[model samples]
Target chain A: MTPFDTRGLKRRRFKDKIFTSIVWGLTFSCLLVVFIILFYIFKKGIGSINWALFTQGPKPVGELGGGISNAIVGSLMVVVVAALFAIPMGVSVGIYLADNRGKKWAERVAIAVDVLQGIPSIVIGIVIYIWIVKPVGSFSSLSGSVALAIMMLPPIIKNTEETLVLIPNTLKEASLGLGASYFKTTMKILLPTGIGGIFGGCIIGIARITGEVAPLLFTAFGNPAMVKSIFKPVDTVPKVIFAYASSPYDDWRRIAWGGSLILVVFIILLNAIIKLFERKWKVQF
Target chain B: MKNRWRILENKIFVRWLSISAILTMVLLLMFFLTLLVSSWPAIKANGFSFLWSKNWDPVNSHFGMLPFLIGTLITSFLALLISAPFSIAAALFLGEFYPKGVIPNIFRNVIDLLAAIPSVVYGFWGLYTIAPLISHLQQKMHLQASGLGIFTASIVLSIMLIPYSVSLIRQVISMTPTPLKEAAYALGSTRREVITKVIIPSNISGISAGFLLSLGRALGETMAVTILIGNAPELPHSIFSPSYTMASVIANEFTEAVDEIHTGSLIEIGLLLFVVTTIINLIGRLIIKRAIA
Candidate 1:
């Protein structure tokens, strides 16, 4: 290398320092923001959390030792119901699109899924609130679960179908040649093969729906206390947190942090589960 | 004869799954159609004037969506601008530079965790945490008390989009041919030069596509924008001025929308966002297909 060109590689130490500092600054600030958020939430929210917050109802005015039992039940109910509605339907549809790729309808269905995937969850909530809950004259968990189910469908369908499609056709033909029916072949061969991705899809679908507050806001109609049934109005953590945090009472605000922490934990745990499943079951199609 | 009936059962199973798939397709269509239909009233009533009208005064009968539209675009665009360079660099580093070791896995999982954080928590955290940091910057600069505005929202929104953009760009950069990099290095180019010329040029479309996808994400984002930017529907004179987004407007006011027009206008805002995203995705799909082929 020429000395002139080699000198081009060398610069003032200040320039090097500046470049180094900029890179460090960006990453460090990003890290700091994340750390600070968690710190604040834990600082404000953890003190109010206790076993009583789990066993009893939400705290009333000047009251203490009540629990998020209602919000917990409500959140769990909507999450489970949404999954039940979304998982089977989304997976089966994904299977058809992937396994039956040669069919005319599959391409059309794929486009349709993309459109569905694009629509916002809040819009879904608003539509159901207008058409379903408005006409039904009752705000119920059933409607909220349905909205959440609709919200959950596209992600599960997209990921599960994509995962299944990544499985080579040879496996399907081999299963078919063994006298396995299409349904049985899909069940035993395709689904199991893509089980990790399917699990990931389910985790994503669950995370997407569980945190949905806008849809539930209009349909589920947040009830601060414990819920009795899926057919009735109940409190979920997001809705509760939204309302309680903004209210006049400090206690409600404190509970909002607790609920926020709970919600964050649930989502993180779901994602962690997906990561574990992905590693444990790495069967390739 | 027994085998024929068994075949019939198998046929039924496949067909039934097909029907279920078809049902899902139908439901997806219904969502689009319903959003369009619900949003049509405001669109029809306003005509092209809706896009041009600036004032968003819901108190008066006159309500326009220009400011929200601009706010959404600006905040999201700003986010894409600030996040894109770092995201691309990070993606390349992860895909082509980072050692294939525990560190890569750790970094990858951290990215994944960022993606998993719930929108509401992000929102609240943006409000209480990020907003203050932003406002603190103003204090140090001796700016006004109200510096929590579009720029703040844009930065936070960019933070929200980082994982998606970085992962996508990383995958794209990694997918480039090894020979391309080797050729660049053989030419005696530095690593930076190789990335800028050989690596990025090869994957320019994908990187552009990532930004577009993220732009769409920033546009649709509601919770994060709501918390960081003080929700005043206006075209800010500068980035530090308050503004509202289309999604945040609907979110904040949907419940309290007293009249049908009010609700309809908000839904119309949603419809606009939907159309915008759909077009972006469709164009992206076409580009990706062309790029691959």
Candidate 2:
């Protein structure tokens, strides 16, 4: 028998061990980073999360305590308005893309959606500023919501299309066979079955735009005082954080941390809800 | 009568859906056209020099995108360089080493959470934590620095990019056929050998496409880069030098720009960013399609 090369075998084994260790080490480091960031955010922001942080408006400069009530209200207003605009349109387009998958126009629209998803938020801000804010002669929460609605469209559409695509064609065939119209088949059969995913997509879309500061930077314009009208400038949590965190005032910076904590908690809740929905509503067929 | 009413309703519904779908395309076109119209004055005045020139004096009415362009390219490429290896390793670990287990699921969730964290939050965190560390390191090295510079921005950007690239790579890696892997194992190959030789070699196209998609993402990231990049419009002379990316410059200047030419120039930069990102994303998407095919 030929002599076996024990040294070569040993070297290969050693190399494999080294590579595996490196992979595990790098992965653990990535996970460690997530923990570190979460830890720091919670630590820094936890103390500042109190009744006043959600109840009152911003205090004047150099003041010790104030809340982001204006920002909180503004965020809700803008995001809810954006959802109102985006959800219907996004779902409609999603349906169109899924129903007419192979058509030339549908393919073009799908590509456009993908490209739209890639456009930077700041650029969206600029376009919206030119299109809405400039023509209206003012920056308003309405304009901000419009920009955000645009940003929200791609994900909502993509998700709805994908979710609908996964549903068996038998459902649609059966619906049509029962003498239901295309509209009825879609509304009665397809949408309800996929509602969990569509709703999850809407929540994800909300989470995405909720923390967006760029498009709002130009369109919302960041009002410090409380705003009641959608046509007026409004403060959002992310915009407030951006303004406050960059400021030199220690008090404002504290408020910024408080705002960050709220934002993070909100996002985490949204994600958890998405996970829950995905698991609960997963259709077997 | 009921059948006729149903047909009418279906036609209306289908028509509305088609209109909505067409509006998505219209919106994209509007973005391009509005940017073109808003930036026309600068485009006309500066001509092609707007692209290659480095001069950006608002008072003198001179605006050029070269420095920011270079800054954007450098920071993005640097971020890709820093992130690619680590993300690849992490992906292999999760998708191959622990492909179906509690450990891999936890790791996957962590990575997804990484992507879910807001970019502004990342910027805020980096400004306080990573920026100070980089500043201290630079001072120790006797280099003039604020800790908020290209390198600092790239580091934070790389962290953000990792979730994206890792998810993409892990997806393609997991999709690597089981039979091929088993064949390598049957041939007395070590796991590392199976990965490096059989799996990676076959999935090279998908892997490259994943990285390309991440690079496209890195190019357009604004908030983290804006907060950490120090917003200097000058060309960076060193890795530690403060600089402006195309997106950051727009975010920093668009609201404050008072001059007509300045506003136009800023819009022009936005136009440039839109075009470049669209092209990169298209190429990445094309590559992904080809790889899948």
Candidate 3:
């Protein structure tokens, strides 16, 4: 190579090293922020998580000792109800989208799902308020679950569609060749084959809604007492955190911290499970 | 006889599943229609002036969404400005510098964890830790107002946006054709030069798609902003001034809105948020489509 070319190459190499170092620095800092946020929550919240914090309902104002048992139960009830309503519908839609790829109705449903996914959570709260809360004449846990179910649909649908679509068409062709009907093939073979991914999708959907507070703000409409009925208003972990943290009470804010910790842990665990499933299932064509 | 019955059962089952699938579209239409119908009362009352008017008084029966609209735009844009560069750089590091093995994998996992961190938890952290830290800095700078304002919210938002945008952009960058990068390196071009001259330029659409998607998310974000944005109703004079976003307003007021006008106006705000975020998301989706094409 010519001297000029060699010199130019050397200059570019030095510049690239500096630039690469800068990029590495940026990545390091970004990771640091994520860790800091997680560490901050754990540090601030750990002290607040006592045994009573799990066992009893929140105490009255100015009270020293209480827990988020009501919020815990309320959150679980809402999430379970949401999953029950959303999973079948979402999976069906996913099946439709993947099975009928490039079809007009499928395209329309896909667009609708995307738009629904993009709608602000607070707006869903309002729509559910008008749809269920007004018609039923009260804010209830049922309404909140419906709102969350709407929010949960997109994740489940998207994931299931992607998963099922990855199943080779030859599998379906073979099933048909063996005299299995379309419904029988899909239900018996396809769904089972993609069950891991579908389960991950459901978990993702559930995780997505677990900490959602805005939809429950006007829908479930937080209750101080733990009500056994889904038809009654309920206090969720997120709603409780929002309500307490905003107030001036010291103990309430600590309770909020405890609730935040629970929520963070729950989400992390759900995500980890999804990751494990994806790795373990490592599908090969 | 059993075989014929099975055939009929399969047909009926398929029909039922198809109906369930189509219900998604119907549900989405109903959601949009409900918002429009609910907001009609406020829309009719305010007319076009609602878009311009700054007054949001419920007692006096006046409502305008200007402050919230501006607040949402400013905070989201500010967040984008702070996060985009860092996300791009991180994407470059992961996609180009360390495409595999321990370091990149660790970074990827951390990003996923960040994405899974609940919005309320972020809000809690912002309210307790970041807000106090910002307030302390402001005190040192002798700035007026507490640190719980547009700036604090934007910082928190930027932090949240990084993991999301990085994941998207990194996917884009990593998917760049191998031959393209190889050709650049074959020409004595350095890694940075290959990234700037080849990979990023080729994948601009995907990068922008990621950016727009993140902007959409920041715009609709509620819990974090509601907790950190100070929830002041007035138009913000500065980043340090307390403000409210469209999402925050709906979140903060929808429950307490007693008057029909108040409720209607809040719903109207929700409608506006729905429309803006939908447009942004659609554009992002379109850009991703184009990138794939």
Candidate 4:
């Protein structure tokens, strides 16, 4: 080959090199920020997560004896309660949307679900506060869960509907061809196949609701101690973090960071669990 | 008779589930109506100036939202400005340039990981890490107040939105027919020509829609922004000036609002935000769908 083609090749190779460099630059830049944030949180917060932090309620602003045990438990209580109320309703709606006989109505329903999903989280919080809390005139865990449940609903419903619809048409036809009815075909053939996607949805929905602070603020009115009644004022990790981070007390601020870190890890773990479950489902279901 | 019963039972199940599905939509619509009606009281008092005023003082009877509204628009527009080009480039590389190997896998995981990070942690990062970076810039600029203002907040907000924009754009770009690119190459056109002329024109609407949708996200974002922006409320023209957004005001001042009008004003501010963001998203969806159609 002549030097003319060689020069052209060189130019192309040069451009390629520049492009790869940019890509690598972007990848490392993103990782650098993410890792730095995670490390800073761990460095600032993890040391304080001792038995006292978990067992005691709240320490005097400086010395450390009391823990955020109550808030942690309270956070779990609301999240669990919200999940309990939201999942069944969301899943049922998802199933209906996915398995409906009327295609036109299904599309309309899908549009509505999308609109609901787009509504801001704080708006949902305010609406729930008005509908549930104002009537009762108290901030309670139930009210908090209700708000969170509504927040959690749209994702699960949308994901479940989408995942179920993605099932191979042949699978459904096969079940029906083998004398199975529409309901049986869906319950067994469609849903089982979509369980992985549904699980992914569930994980994300839970993660979303767990980090939510604005909604919980109006609904739960942060309590200092672990309250047993679901209808009583409750503390959540996010609420604690928000309240304590801005507080005048240094100890409260440290605990707030610690709480924030715990939430970050929990979210990361849940994501990993969803991926791992998806992988396993790719094998079995 | 038994066969007839079996057919009827199956139909009933189908009917019931469809009804349930329809019900979810109906209920959600009802909830939206409730929100509009419930907030009408606040809306009536504030009038349309609910959006134009900036003074958010609660002690005095003065209620201005121009600052928060401007703040929301400024931060969102800034985020779109910063994130759009990078996301488009990254998406192009992922869709066109990158060999399907470790790099793409890493990129995919990074994108997913970015979305997975909690917003609160993003807030903390803005506060501890990013804010310090801004403070350094402020010193360099010889500014008295910290330069951790709207611009710094916008940077953080942009970082937060890149993942959503990138993946969605990548998906749209990948859906383009390959032959168009092949034809461009066959005509002795370059990769840049193929992308800028062929792929982009085909998917311009989706690309723009993606940016606008993420802008909507930026408008609603509170946690990260609240930490970075110096939360001073006023009608400042410079990005370096500290400001408050509609959302941060709702989050920060909702409880501390002293009286009934103060609380109502805050709610009025939120309603304005909700209306703006919802309209942006709705228009985006319609535009993108129209493009595809």
Q: For candidate 2, lDDT tens digit of each residue in A174-257?
A: 999999999999999999999988998898899888889988889998998899999999999999898887789888888888
Q: For candidate 4, what TM-score does chain B get against the true chain B?
A: 0.89
DockQ of each: 0.45, 0.81, 0.77, 0.43
Leading candidate by TM-score: 2
What docking tier does model 2 reach? Answer: high
Please compute the TM-score of chain B alone for each predicted structure, in the order given: 0.92, 0.96, 0.96, 0.89
Tens-digit lDDT track for model 1 on A1-285? 554764555653445455445544554455555566667777877887878767777766787557688888898998898899989988988888887676788878877776666666677777787778878888889889999998788888878887988888889899999998887788788888888888888888998788778778778877866777887888888877766654677777777788888887788888888888877875553
Task: Point out the worst 10-residue segment of candidate 4 chain B by lDDT.
Answer: B284-293
Off by over 4 Å in 1: A1-5, A9-33, A61-65, A102-104, A166-171, B1-5, B139-147, B289-293
Q: Model 2, range B196-249, lDDT digits (tens) per residue?
A: 999899999889989988887888888889999988888888999999999898
RMSD of each: 3.0, 1.4, 1.7, 3.2
- The candidate maximizing DockQ is 2
lDDT of 4 by residue, B1-293 (tens): 98888789889877777676777777666665766676676667667776676666676767778888788788889888987767887777676677378878677666666676666667766766777777788778777557568988888888888788887777778777889889988987667667778989989988888787788788878776776777888875688778888888777787666666777777666666667676777777777666554
Looking at model 1, give its docking quality level.
acceptable
Candidate 4 accuracy as TM-score = 0.90
True contacts kept of each: 0.34, 0.78, 0.81, 0.35
Tens-digit lDDT track of model 3 for B1-293: 98998899988878876898778878877877898998898899989889889888888999988999899999999999999889999988888788899868878898778888888878888887889888998888788748799999999999888888998888888889999999998997878889999999999989999999999999999999999998888899888888999999988888788988889888888888888888998889878766755
Best by lDDT: 2
lDDT of 3 by residue, A233-259 (tens): 999999898888878988898888888
lDDT against the true structure, each candidate: 0.78, 0.90, 0.89, 0.77
